[model samples]
Target: MKLRELAHSRTGDKGNTLNVSVICHDARHYEHLRREVTAERVKAFLGDVVRGAVERYELPCIGAFNFVLCEALGGGVTRSLALDAHGKSLSSALMDLDIAAPD
Candidate 1:
């Protein structure tokens, strides 16, 4: 199953950093997402787009996970030449990540 089936995401950008938050539709599925979506996994999934470290912050209270991606914006909104420098589409792209169905 895709992550999108279980959660939705929001994105924010600061300079070359990108922040993505994944919030589960059902709180019960939080554990499953937590297990499947790791910083390493996210970095691998995003590939070359991310040039630095990936940090994962668990928000168990809200059944969410926040990922901080460094050097992902090509530079920064004002400095990047990329069309989607703000990385709004990044959250939507992340939703496509594949994960095992909740047990």
Candidate 2:
């Protein structure tokens, strides 16, 4: 399943860092997300844009995961020439990551 079917996301950025939060629609699905949504997968999904590393923090109580993408903004909005340098749509893009459909 795509992440959007089970979760939703929000994003923020500071300089070259990007933070994307994935929140589960149901608490029961948190475990599945924890298993499936790895830093590796996120890094791979975001691809070349993420120049540094991917770090994932789990929030069990909130049934959410926060992904920190280092050096991902093309050098931040002020420095980045790329359109949408702020990475505002990154959360929406992340929802497209493929995962096993919940049974």
Best-matching candidate per TM-score: 1
Model 2 residue runs over 4 Å out of place are none
Model 1 lDDT tens row, 1-103: 9999999999999999999999999999999999999999999999999999999999999999999999999999999999999998888999999999999
For model 2, name the residue pairs that clash: 1-99, 1-100, 1-101
lDDT of 2 by residue, 1-103 (tens): 7999999998899999999999999999999999899999999998998899999999999999999999999999899987889787888899999999765
Those runs of model 1 whose alpha carbons end farther than 4 Å from true positions after fitting are: none
Give the Å error, residue 31, model 2: 0.1
lDDT of 1 at 64: 97
* lDDT of every model, 2 decimals: 0.95, 0.92
For all candidates, the clash counts are 0, 3
